[model samples]
Target chain A: MTYIIKGDGSKEKYDEKKLAKSLKRAGADKHTIEQIKALVRKKIYNGMTTKELFGLAFREFRKLQPIVAPKYDLKGALYRFGRSGFPFEALIERILVFQGFECRRNVTSHGKAVTHEIDVKAKKGSQVLMVECKHKSKEHLTIHIQTPLYVYARFLDVKKEFTKPMLATNTKFSGHSTRYAKSVGLRLLGWSYPKDDSLQSNIEKYKAYPITMLRGITPDLLERCIKKEVLLLSDIHGKSPEQLATLLGIAFQKAKKIAEQCKVCELK
Target chain B: MTYIIKGDGSKEKYDEKKLAKSLKRAGADKHTIEQIKALVRKKIYNGMTTKELFGLAFREFRKLQPIVAPKYDLKGALYRFGRSGFPFEALIERILVFQGFECRRNVTSHGKAVTHEIDVKAKKGSQVLMVECKHKSKEHLTIHIQTPLYVYARFLDVKKEFTKPMLATNTKFSGHSTRYAKSVGLRLLGWSYPKDDSLQSNIEKYKAYPITMLRGITPDLLERCIKKEVLLLSDIHGKSPEQLATLLGIAFQKAKKIAEQCKVCELK
Candidate 1:
């Protein structure tokens, strides 16, 4: 057992098996994983932040396979999500699933006055949440405050069993919107709204890393992988190089490269 | 001299020349116009309302031409706007032109955070208005209250020359939306919003009827006409039947029928 400092300054005993599992989930190869495991065992000491540990592993991982370095860079990889034409609703649904909620996507329900096309309807016991995803191509756009009001109106219109309406956007939100959300009791999750519960925070909590965040994966290849329904890093992490090549219709070498780097990419 | 009662119960002497000019504007035939005039003269009385006069003329207009009746039915014809893939912004611009406002269409402007695509910008001296048209296919959809808020945010982002923003929609707006619009000072012109200043009122006030509202025109034919930029009812009102047939590449009878009907359809 190794004591490692976390981002929040809390220290926890790190298990090698957990590290290896996450690395495998990240798509690291057997040889790379063994190398990273040996390195972690040798260098890891008390008071070393997980950030430092991640940097150490990332450096070694990059040296072994530079093509997959970005796949391991969580924050940078999340930003790269803006470039892909992936289904955002699926990402949100997966996060809801990770949160132990049942989700029905693209539901059409009749309102009192007008029918609504809900993007996702999540349910658990008597509590229900309707989530709206506003995906924009550009990073500069922000969700205005009225979105909460608009979303809330729709929620009231068709509140059959839902507890409340929550809006999720890939971009940030305005100050007005955050205040409006609080006032109207509309749950909002954006790039940066409701600082405690944002889209970024949800992704972090769920660990739903986008496959496009990987360095070796070009948008064209990512699109092909998405076509094959391999949307996230974990979706393709467990697959063998040969299987990946066959499924993604790429070369064995490229697939192996992707698979190997992804497996040991996580230092923690 | 025959006196006619008006909508407000005021009396005015009916002028035959004024009647003939309005008939021509409504796309009526000369023979039909003459017949209607004769009927109006035969039926005129001091207590006869202008509504009664209009009804008498409409009955005669319908008898002379059944196909063109809907085109003259302003409200019903406006509803037909949903059928054709007509460029609505252009129609709105034409209305603005009649309102004596100079316009520029689809102008792009850079804001502090992001660039915005302005739909239509109308300018008159020191006063300028940025207009956004929200065209929906379904009649049931209402512009939510947040739209005013959303639009106002965009307006604030890029307020180059336009001092005010106006949102126009083909459908109705939510009660909350109307209240919000009033609160925020965002001018809204929907099917029945800003009751004194609505899209319906604008259409009536400007006499800017869409070319697609013509009865002799099919959606396919209207598409072709729109492609040729013949968007308003008055665009081809001056063209001869043969010229219209030649220009539109349709049969002589069809063009003649359209030309004949459009000439007097404006007799209000």
Candidate 2:
């Protein structure tokens, strides 16, 4: 009967299994997962907010395994995107580019009935993609069915120009929306949507962690990095901290800390 | 050169030719048009608002030919629709039903990608129409190109349920929107758009004036009538003033005036 307050001020029964499942999905080893669960159980109290509970778990995971901690909090990093959703769109474009797709962001093209401001357009040899990025900053909200509905509509308008339609998101998709998308051959990539290839898997496979996940940087700094098109950890993989400090106009120590965190996340 | 302040607070040089053309379109006789033109010329002053000029013209038109005056001020009456755009949608549904189409208002149907709340869905034998009502309360705003784009996208989603997509509005369509709609085989219906089959022609041909055009009732009463599904003057064509008063909970004199106005508008 343990109840926890959710981010939206609603109360829900605290479920230990859900936290364990999320930790597992974050690639935490079983031993570390057990230790985190023990710590969370000891700290669990009535009327605690879910944010506090997750923060505790994330801290413990970071302490136990620094390398995998970034991945564990990847969803949180994605949530740091601003309300405009532009940074999320840019991140999707960069991720696609890392995967060998020639990608363009914020592209405008005429559809059959009207012009569309496509978030990301990618092409690889014979494959062309019209990717719509639906970014929600809140954790509980899923990509609804209406998105793919309108997205498919936009694709139908510009199908002559693009070979396929894809919807990318930072969160998961509703069951009905996923089924509808699957039925129409509309590809979906989200936190945990499609079985094998998802937003998480794509980022993990290429180690293209969003710059927001780096330690010792504020949201404002992350925004400037996004504006400078430095979204991925790989974007600063080889650069020295001094170079990053000059590029981002930040303190040398803050840049060094971010650089160190990026190296840790990029570890094999 | 007389400058008239438009509804949007932009100033424009007054054109007598445009006034005459609008009067002619409202079914005014040449002699009456000449008299209204003379009156407008006499009243024209620098820095006069377009609303004031139109009020003078509408008043003169009412005195000369009261029957056609409602049609002349039809655009203004349409602009009285609330920001929610529901009443305008109801008006379009009534107009379609008058034209022998089996019409349904606010119909929800599942498209391939999602469910859409269509403003008006009309059916005639094998011909099915999915109509989107883009009602604008502002007089200066036109139906832009983006509307038909999304409407067509929704149509493509539900094309299995509907034969064609049609965009209807109380205002005019921008030239680019009209051309884009035409090129994509999307039907366009708006004020003075599509020549013979425009919304104005349809209303005049069938005399299906909106209840908002009735002189006696206020906007609150018009909203109440819309809530009671009384959008068209034809809806109250045969009802006596006493019965209308009983149904609408309004004063008998107000109901009588509305009945009298409907009679005048419905005159062949």
Candidate 3:
């Protein structure tokens, strides 16, 4: 055991079990988790900050599994989806697919009063849902009550079509906003909202890591992928590097590296 | 009549009747109109721009009828309401009063799903109204369809408390926005909408000029007046210079000048 300072300035003893739990949450296999733990343990010193400790483990994890390493910094990786919210909406559509929902992105629905360009219209079984994706680039920001207010009002305008409304964000939700949304029965999903079920949890469970997580993916390249509807790692899974290069209009070597990263993120 | 360049870069013969008609629209008296006409006619020369002719007319009109001169540039004066929309909301409240409606400014009303801070809520007889005031500082910008969609959604949320909803703007509304608002039975008020009963016509008919139309009012001073709920030119009408100075925290001489200007805008 080693004493370490946390991100919030609190000092505590670092245990290997805690490190393994986080890796497990990122969907690392037991063997890879042990390898990362041993690699991190060698770099530990008294009073080392958790950040420095995380950096050590993250580097070695990346070398071992490039695909899963991005998942280790999942929150940071998601932030790379950029500010437009289109790619983030694309990610949400894929996650909904894992939940057995058929989705149409950017649907223009005529409401009771005016027409609205909905982010996503999802249909699961016999129920249809209105999904509003709110993306923020910064960390520690909270979705306020006004968002849910307007979102629920929008859903009400198209009530004849959508049976339920869901608000998904890259950040957290304020307590008041959460309470208000709950009272109105509007589903709320954020980084760690709803305890066991959240945007992060759903992404992990569905293995819907975005293509932006790949090492060679630049923002411009990621945007191109989003435009081509190749948002998820699985979307390019099992493709030959030559095929990826032709499909995405990239060089073969770059496509080869991205394809290798996508392999590990493939759902069994 | 000398040929003069118009604002649109086209040349036309200077028509005294056209100049007088505009002054009449600004509520200038017949005597003041004749004085400005004579003043502009003397300054006109062949190839002189209509802008130069109007400048001569406006300067003389200001000397003759200080209060009504601001109305000659009514659209430009309204643009000084600033970007905050608070003073504009205050103006709307006063205008509603002129139409026999008892109005409340910035009322927070609870809705079925969320609470909304309404700009102005008016009640006349058994009917209640929800008012949204949209103020733009730029010229020629139109309120698009999205505004009415959200405004009507907000109204629908609070429909039980209000019988109808009205949208008032300093600029014009796009044709699609107007059609959407009208189809949904929502009232649309702009610089010119709904034919004769537009915002400009109402302001002229009811003499509800904003305090910003007054000369010597700085942006900072106007903000102070808005905070004090002194929005209309009539709000300071009939007040002594000393009273105006104390109410607005300004110089005695400035207040005296403002008070003199306010006298002409007093409602009959």
Candidate 4:
């Protein structure tokens, strides 16, 4: 899983639960998430890289974000990455997907007269984490003030079932900004570079959060475990010649030979 | 300006003129180049970065390439950089604009059945240059084979006024492919890393070639020159008053006073 520090110097895993929560928080409806999922699944192919998936999700989300914005100006702002912000969104999404979460990029909420879009949405089990990712230089940390405003817009669109709002940024938050988030009951997931010990702890803490908050088995974790198993099995299959390996620590060829004999006996 | 080495292990400058020639050779119509120049000029704003302008022109040219392809695709191929072969037709236009060339990124012909577009048209003295650009990886070179084919299709559309063909790649070309291009008389511009001095010389040799048969410009010189200028200006702008005084061989107070004067005079 890709890991990043949250705005409050906490390490957070970019997982499916986090993505779902983020989407819900960003005001995406269940229908929208399902639509996005369908689009991503259809586009997916074998040996697909994480970056490719993120890009696909991003393009899909971009189409949706405009539909949710309140005004054309707001829609423009969401689409505008101002250079550096462009690649950062994809990187964040990739991290989340790697950590075992299902994520969609550029989610938009369509309303009667107004629309809103979130950068990413991650869902795992019942916990739906909404993330607002910012990639500003350290000197521009003061820009954190705008983060909540964007998050609040998303918060209004989230379904009632999800818990907790989180903001993620590559830049550290100012003390004043942290205090404001705390007062407002918003979770700040911040990370400091050069080996941030605090971030590591936050990941561990969040991992233990009650699973009931998540819908079911975290899709992100399940995917990761499955991928790992597939990789291990493929490695074994490469070395072993037998269809069935022996229970004992025998050579793969011997196991395959035994399996073939067993198959012959069964055939007879 | 981005510089790159050619396939023959030579360094080359990404000259706007060379790009223009490639576009002309690709069979782009004069009207297309004119339209592109106007568009770029109209959309340009103060403090616009080179990369931003390139993207703007690329988008514009993407809208026009299909229209002029009947006569221009062969020469236009040299401007593409990436795998998608989406026309970066505005690259030369942007380069020229950066160098004070009066070029525009405008639309020429619109596709009725296809949504694809072309970028811009360029004029140097009496000559008009039509271009498209591709930004691609070396591993994905095959992705661009269809580009020439598309240009060929466009050639058929316009009644064959444009006759030049050009192909540019940031990655190295395969020997078999190079031989194929040579056999067919297609101009292939392959670019690689620019740090090598020998490669740079080869690029220079290609640069000296007439636009009629030239493939593409080297990305190394263009990128280096732009980088040097940007870096120098950034450093100069970041200096403290005291530092400026030392550099100018003047007293700190006097230097501050002069700096203020220079700022007022727009001389800094």
Candidate 5:
């Protein structure tokens, strides 16, 4: 079979049949050659550039080699999972940052009490949260049997006020295992593929807002805003922000400001 | 913060603060509880239903755990790479099937010459292709070293006439390693995430088509198709039946028949 290279190479046409023959001669089985041929045939489009096609064909043919398969599969799986856009660990850090927390990944702590590498160390206000992450195939089960050990280790290292330990998995946990986690006071979080609504909501909720919104925003500033009636927080049932803002004779921002103040006041 | 319990539950109005305190009492970290509360606040719409927020919170929380973080991250990567929609191995198999071959996944073989479990096995006519898929993290560099052993093992198990060994990985190969593989005549396929079209095209070039296409077809028939211009036997180019049949002025069944016949003829 002849292949017309579609990319920017000078040699635009090559005999794929010859290539297969060469591969067979070079120790590729006839079946493997045929497989290669079929693959090439299925994907070639009209007006495809030669360089592109050759690169594509070369990579595909390479798969028949033993050394490249595992890494290829891992990379493939990673891309499928959306980690290709950004380093997965980095994305986690970004999410943590957006959530109004400071986070560190792959942190190790060593002390007389414990020795462990935490996937993430997060601080919100006075609380310190240690996070561990595991990425494995479905056949590999995830259990946070080491949570207590890590907690103990962290206790030895920082001696900060301890918060509950956190464990996360892409897969679901066994009922008994989850119960065990609960029994030990470890918090468990599971995330599956195709970001579900609840997860998305969490992401959105924690996302950082624009700096303009932060103007004069101190923890106690909400109290002043509420006292001055610069905003009014009310239960306007089933009203859109625009509708409610219009009814209250305020800008959406002012209404949102009022809501924020109310929340702070309520919390206090 | 008040929550409402719906249906079958004895309680109607439940206090959200009470629930948060209970979770805190249950050993949930303050940060996690806060994250959960934010998640609930963002998602709770008018007429918001039950207080199953704890379960939702638990699910979200699990993704952040260390022991399981890798699994979730990998899943996200796989989904991004387009493998998460199906069983992890199925995507690999599908690519092989697209090359017009009968493919099986996760086959175990044990023999004096070969003792290993192969991730995929593909057959076309007389040729048998053994594939091993390794999904590894940086922590497991050993996966890269294992491919050659797997190939050698597979090569030993099958009679020289029937078997061909292949490897697929998501990682890039080192120069020295690539040279070593080429020296041994092993086929190596590599893919990175984010679905590089070029790489995918390369993968497509070597992928085997579904075995069903070979039904009622013989190697001679395929050769005849090639000779008679009934079907084009090109290397992995325009090979998908749905695409090829239309261009060739034949039904996919007819094209498949011709191709299978060619496969049979080639085997002879």
Candidate 6:
């Protein structure tokens, strides 16, 4: 079995089966799978990291399926959010708003007894949900029972004055946690939980992908745009590339490249 | 089969097995159980409610065991706490202190982003826990799954700015709920969960029994004492009958009767 280097410089077996599964999940056809497998075989080596392999695969995957490629790759890119010294929680606020939920991030509410500091509070119709976002860079780490318990416990203190409690993680939840949370009625939205209502599904459904997901934009530049209320890539459409470059202090060419990527985010 | 009315005015078949179990749990010997059973049988009528039956059994049960009787009966008296307009969360704050925890209730902390209204934030050594206390007037009602979910969701919002979250209920937790809470690692202190360390057990352990649990004190009189910083029956010990009546505006005879009950609360 050939091994691939990880972000932490550790080695692990490169499982073809895992790749095939991810590809299938992205709606790649049999012909495309076979073509991608050939490209992987041609490119991978003993010391190559999984990040390099993802870049190679993503390039080939994009050729086979353009629309699905970015969504699939964006899912991978999201895992990097943990590293950016950014208020990704704010980005999440924008996405929830796009999904038609009235959302506020980093808010303080004066309840009858104490003031509550909320990360993200979203309300849709009569339903209000308070979300705890756990962002992990590594996919292998699972959110165990501790998170739900802590969240539930906090919510209990202020439940009479606040919204419903939920746990959202970049990675998946442990089986035991999911079972426990469901039994307690704690809502969970992980990478793949709630099936069609996972984080990826919510982002895809709204087509309101965060500006940080774009290739050329750094977290600092993105924050400036966010401060100016330009949250989604689609929000960049009305601006000229020259103005975008000047406003964000990026090169004209880089700004144009980011604008090009935002074009694909336009929904019906 | 005989039927009895519940608090909701609903009728159900009287189950002697349940009564036997409760009697057994309260440390009743076999002879005492038989005596209580005989009395329950003699008092049977067409329209008697469960509350009436409890009174009949309690009077006899106390004769058999005085110390255990107060503790057991204290569990029953707690259900009436919800009816009093007094802030019982303050009582919970005192209980935590007796358990070797530093507790503050109805506290507001100004965090970096928002002000937090904390019901009870308790600290033991380096560990700090935020508690949500659910006060109930009926023993039949259990803290269900929706509670933890709401608690957890609210925690998700403010966890970043607060301490660890926990849930405490005046009554028992449902079987599914206990199992779920354990799985998720949420520290729970319902009337009878974590058996040895349950909310009821904690009250018993610390001798932090509520003043309302005194045999003759009414909720009205108790609320008045609570207003005067007299929370526990033990707190009643230092006051003379005359002073107690003067402080709370009750009759001298009623104050003497309350003083009589306070004698049993002398901690070991």
Best by TM-score: 2
- What share of the reference contacts is kept in model 3? 0.24
Candidate 6 structure quality by residue, lDDT tens digits, A7-123: 778999988888888887666778878898888988788988998988888788878766456655766557656454334575577667777888877666553333456678889
DockQ of 4: 0.01
Q: In model 5, what lDDT does residue A100 have?
A: 78
**Model 3 CAPRI quality:** incorrect
Candidate 6 DockQ category?
incorrect
* TM-score to true structure, per model: 0.48, 0.78, 0.74, 0.23, 0.23, 0.47
Task: List model 6 lDDT by residue over B59-133, tens digit each.
Answer: 898888655566658776677664653346766788778878888776675433234466788888777776777
Residue range A102-176, candidate 4, lDDT tens digits: 878777744222343567777777766666677553333443443543354345335452355667655566664
Error of 4 at B89 (Å): 47
**Proportion of native contacts kept per candidate:** 0.10, 0.34, 0.24, 0.00, 0.00, 0.05
Which 10-residue span in candidate 5 chain B carries the lowest summed lDDT? Answer: B66-75
**Against the true structure, whose DockQ is highest?**
2
Model 1: residues >4 Å from true position, as ranges?
A1-167, A170-268, B1-68, B71-76, B79-86
Residue B234 displacement in candidate 2 (angstroms): 3.0
User: Candidate 1 vs candidate 3: which has greater DockQ?
Assistant: 3
**Two-chain DockQ for model 2:** 0.27
lDDT for model 5 comes to 0.46
Candidate 3, residues B1-268, lDDT tens digits: the string is 5899875688898888888898988778899999888777677789887667767887888888776688877777788885686778877778889999999988998987667789999999998999989999987678987677667767877889999989999999987787778777789888867779998888878878788778857888987888888888878888999999999999999998988888756644
Residue-level lDDT tens digits of model 4 in B1-268: 4443454445554444554554454344566566656665676554554445455555555467543232222222233231233223333343434434455554454322222233444455654433334455333354233343333233222213223333444455555344434433444544532233221123232221111111222344224323333111122344567875666454687545433322211211
Sort every candidate by TM-score, greatest first.
2, 3, 1, 6, 5, 4
Q: Evaluate every candidate with DockQ and list the scores.
A: 0.06, 0.27, 0.20, 0.01, 0.01, 0.03
